[model samples]
Target: MRILLAYDGSPAAETALGLAISRYGDDELVALYVAEVDPTTYDASAFGGGTDDVPDSDEAEAVLEEARERAVQEGYELETAVEQGSPSDVIAEYADEHGFDQIVMGTHGRQSISEVIVGSTAEQVVRNSPVPVLTVR
Candidate 1:
């Protein structure tokens, strides 16, 4: 299926990942993590606080690694990417640029934040994607 999974390492995103793993065949998956360069997080040397340690890039890498491991364990061919930018934009770009057939992702479950589609990444991706996006809670 050449699918892309947008993971944020959140419990919600993880649940979506679990669903995706169970639904697709091993040969039809590609996992992705977007760095989500948040302007609020911009700093010259912000890499030393545990509470503030979850930089989008690092978080993205961690999630992608987990997704790839899952795919490998399930015998699926896996590809990974880490790009810097908005989550929705990056996911859409990756899917389009890589010729993905579908996108599977998890949302944060924030149901009122319009700026972020209920404050969830999944919502934003679904709203901004050119291709079909399957959102898992």
Candidate 2:
């Protein structure tokens, strides 16, 4: 089975990564890190105000590298990908485009007003994903 693992270097993501490695060690695992670009940044750039604070691919790569190392420590090799977009959108689209059989991700378990305003990435992915999603907290 092909599994898309959403990794963001968070503690919850670490837990998910370890779970995926242990439970689906024989499956094809791809660690995906989505570099979320703020839409306002793009809008500002379009209006001639270039922002240096935009999330870069390098940051995404670094997180994916960490995921790879963790997988290695667990005796598994992981393929890594870095994508630019909203985390949930990127994850769901990548899983569909790559024909992944399942998606494994972490839930931040945020229960604050900010969570209500911005919604949880895990919840959004679970609602939008074409394939089954296994979320770890």
Candidate 3:
């Protein structure tokens, strides 16, 4: 099966990667890192703050490299990609556009009011994804 693993270098994401590797080692796996671009017009730089929400190219590369290394350690060749957009949208769209059979990702598992107000990426992806999404916490 063709699987797309949404990787963000988080602990949960690492767990998801490990699970995918162990269960679907021989499947076609692609680790996708979505660099969430801030859609707001607010500029943090003007207020003496750095724009840390949006990751740079180097950071994206580093995350992909880490995923690749982990897959290699498991004796599997993994494909990787970096995309810029809302994480949930990019993940779901990429899976559909790339003809993936399923998507595997990690969830923060936050149940607080803030999480309810602003849903987590995994929740959004689960709601909007074209294929089945397996979320590992």
In terms of lDDT, the best-performing candidate is: 3
For model 1, the stretches where C-alpha displacement exceeds 4 angstroms are 39-59, 109-119
- Local distance difference test scores for all models: 0.69, 0.83, 0.84
Q: For candidate 1, what is the TM-score?
A: 0.71
TM for every model, in the order presented, reads 0.71, 0.83, 0.83
Candidate 3: segments with Cα more than 4 A from true spot:
40-55, 109-116
lDDT of 1: 0.69
**Steric clashes per prediction:** 2, 0, 0
Per-residue CA lDDT of model 1 for 14-48, tens digit only, reads 78777778887564677666554566765424655
lDDT pick, better of 2 and 3: 3
lDDT, candidate 3, 19-88, per-residue tens: 9999888999999987766658645455454334345758878888999999999899899988766788
Q: Model 3 Cα RMSD, Å?
A: 5.0
> Model 2: what TM-score?
0.83
Better of 1 and 3 by TM-score: 3
